[model samples]
Target: MAGTLTVWKFPTETGAETAVATVRDLRRRRLITLHDAAVVSWPAEATKPKTRQLRHLAGIGALGGGFWGLLFGILFFVPLIGAAVGAGIGALAGALTDVGIDDKFIEELKERITPGTSALFLLTSDAVLDRVLDEFRGQSPELISANLSHEQEDKLRRAFAE
Candidate 1:
């Protein structure tokens, strides 16, 4: 099945969590199929960062979970230290290219998703776009990136941008 990976950025961590909760509702209604998802948040007063991965879809062993773990580790965890450590993580990120997740995606996310904000990384298939978007009618969440066809991507961009 064809899958789409999208990142939705919100002004606040709670907003992102609310969006994710809506997605869970969509899933419950059988409007979408989610292969994996992750939430990354950086609260303004947080002494520590917060991240959550939907483990229900991870299944047995470490395949899906490990992928998100490594991705988030490079994106969130490694930066707490020095440039030297970041260099090593950069190398490790290059290796992830084989799995269709690359350094560019991570870099774009890091640059766009600022502190005091949160983002939802969604891996989904067979989604009812119209209905799903309807759930977000009042809110304007930035569409960071999506592995989608030009036409479909443009549609989603316009929808959310509206």
Candidate 2:
């Protein structure tokens, strides 16, 4: 089955970290299944964001540090490196696109996840949409982006409608 790549943005820098607990609880209850997850915390005064992959939650087929590192580098570090590295960044970005994450997705993440914000990035499947979303009500997470198949997107929309 195709897993959904989702990014949820939170207003506070620590919000994503706090939501991790809720996600863990949901997983324990079988409300959702996560293949891999990561958090990006950007402080207001900081030059860049800090990223942490949830190693403990990673399953057998989960993506490793290398994937996160490359993604984060492309998202947060590429600008600082300048056009001199454009060629390399392009190649790396192409790799990401090959896996369903396109430029539009990356650009949206860059635009939304500004300083003083935090985002939870999840690679998941088999989610009980309504129940999973209900668990995050307290945090008020904004669904920034999601790469889901047509059927999955329809299911998500229906879940929200109800």
Write down the lDDT of every candidate, Cα atoms only: 0.69, 0.81
Task: Give candidate 2's root-mean-square deviation (CA, Å).
Answer: 7.1
lDDT of 1 by residue, 1-162 (tens): 455777888888666777877888888887888767788888888854588886664322213555666678887788676899788877767765544556687788878776788887777778766776788766567776556554543333333221
Q: What tens-digit string does per-residue lDDT give for candidate 2 at 24-84?
A: 9988988888878899999999999999999898765677787788789888988888897
Q: What is the lDDT of residue 118 in candidate 2?
A: 97
lDDT for model 2 comes to 0.81
TM-score for candidate 2, please give it.
0.87
lDDT: which candidate is best?
2
Which candidate gets the maximum TM-score versus the true structure?
2
Off by over 4 Å in 2: 148-162
RMSD in order of candidates: 8.0, 7.1
| Per-prediction TM-score | 0.75, 0.87
Which regions of candidate 1 deviate over 4 angstroms? Answer: 57-63, 83-85, 148-162
